[model samples]
Target: MTGSGTPPTTIPGSDARSNGLPEAAPNPGQRVLVAGGGGYIGCILTRCLLDRGYRVRVLDRLYWGEEVLGHVIDEIELVQADVRDFPGSALEDVDAVINLSGLSNDPTAEYSPEANWQMNAVATENMADACVARGIDRFVFASSCSLYDGLPAGMHDEPPQSSRAAPTPPPSTTASSTCSRWRAIPSARCRCATAPCTAGRRACATTSW
Candidate 1:
């Protein structure tokens, strides 16, 4: 991972000023807590935030390795821990949280569906509750387009009408349900990025709920 001193124009779908939060003004002084910031996508995102002048703290299990963030290791605060049992102190000074802390693909989920459900669904709800209790309003969840897997071809672009209509795999479905349930929290500004990412191309649809 590489670190830069420039900040990005904005965080996707965040409106810090709207909910009585601090004015972003490009967020130079804001600190973002990125859960799972050592993974493939998370590493890239962590570097981007650092580039944009935001202070970043990464909470990750680092099940793979930390070499992915070697280049910028000195620039971030790294916490080696699982999200499921993360301490409340992780949210203490955090202004916003971007959760990318679950199993990334089908094979991993299939290997242990129990683990998948706990990480993708239950852990997410627990974190969101913690954020709310701490008065942290901004939460960005990295969801998957796989939630639309069983939809008819024509309906792929549309949000699933109901859980029954989607019939996605257990992991993806439960993750999606977690996103929906948190959308109703008045103080939480929940944004879901449904990504259909590939080695050659990455496409994401960001929706605020």
Candidate 2:
């Protein structure tokens, strides 16, 4: 899951901001901060932002090799900082924050539950607080729809509830528990999606398979 944030500015050729997200290009020169911008999804998103004329700054620990960004490393302002230890000052002059920093998968989270909690839950909360304190209101929290696998087969389309509306097939794991909590954070903007993408993942899967 990867979260992206942008101020209320209109993008060219789209009415994307009608959903409380600020327009992506109401005006040019808006600066965006991509936390964990070196990861798989972050790398692609950063490239898109640059192509769209936004100034991008990426903060990533680069646990993955830097090769994903080799072509664009020179094009972006890269900062090597762990999400848990990042400072608010880094967000200065930033118009929005997209938090993609966290353990990327279930095996990693299951292996190191403590670190997972800190990175996925604790660090996320800290980042949201810092963004709010710094007056950066646009926060997009990317969350997995895999958690929805827990839902009953027939209830997938039900209106979302503040609590679990159906019995889950399996007991919750550390990641799901923490994600449920993160979903409830009043300060952060969470996009509760069930894919690795917004719309394209499912479309591509159906077409390819």
Candidate 3:
């Protein structure tokens, strides 16, 4: 969608290191398809990408409204669609993909487990498959530290030894864990970033495979 406004000159949390991307950054101007690019985290992330000179294509259902991206509406390509039912054509001309689409919080997941699974797990798998089919090599899936929620409070960043002993986790945690397993895809260089709670701008520990 095109808008008349200019892109915002400054975004509060636009620092590169704090965005949780890997040390090896993509070259500027590569088109990055950001699924769920209208949500809270996605809005900030889309802006950062634009500021860094990457062309962004946002594919979002806009459940929270498109106003979040109002400033940059004209600066990038915006595709309004659900990630679960995303069209194959949407991936055309995209150099890479950053999947941020999912039921983000526990309350939303608890309210509807089926939708959560579809959005977080099934959609992620489908997106990865789509990327592979199109020969897109770099796929970044936004996972969560919630997978370790079953562990002790201070044990989130620790190894998963304790997490294995935890009881069956909720849908949100399971979905995030499922997405993390995408690193096993042989044809793609997948990176899963275990995102921490967002306060302001912060760095996340990423495990690449």
> What is the C-alpha lDDT profile of model 2 across 1-209, one tens digit per residue?
23467456654424433332343545347788888889878899889778767888999998887888887898888888898898776788988677677766656766876777687767877776676677665565554332343344443332222244433321123333443455587754432222224222222222110
Instruction: Compose the digit string of candidate 3's lDDT tens values, residues 12-62.
Output: 335534555555545887899999889878888889788778899999999
Alpha-carbon RMSD, candidate 1:
8.3
Query: lDDT for each of the candidates?
Result: 0.69, 0.61, 0.69
Candidate 2 residue 39 C-alpha distance from true site, Å: 0.7
Instruction: Give all candidate RMSDs, comma-separated.
Output: 8.3, 10.5, 8.1
Model 3 spans with C-alpha error above 4 angstroms? 1-26, 144-155, 158-182, 189-209
- TM-score, per-candidate, Cα-based: 0.71, 0.64, 0.73
- Top TM-score: which candidate number? 3
Q: Which lDDT tens digits does candidate 1 get at residues 36-80?
A: 899878898888778767899999999989898897799999999
Worst 10 residues of 1 by lDDT: 199-208
The true-versus-predicted C-alpha distance at residue 51 of model 1, in Å, is 0.8
Model 1 residue 33 lDDT score = 90
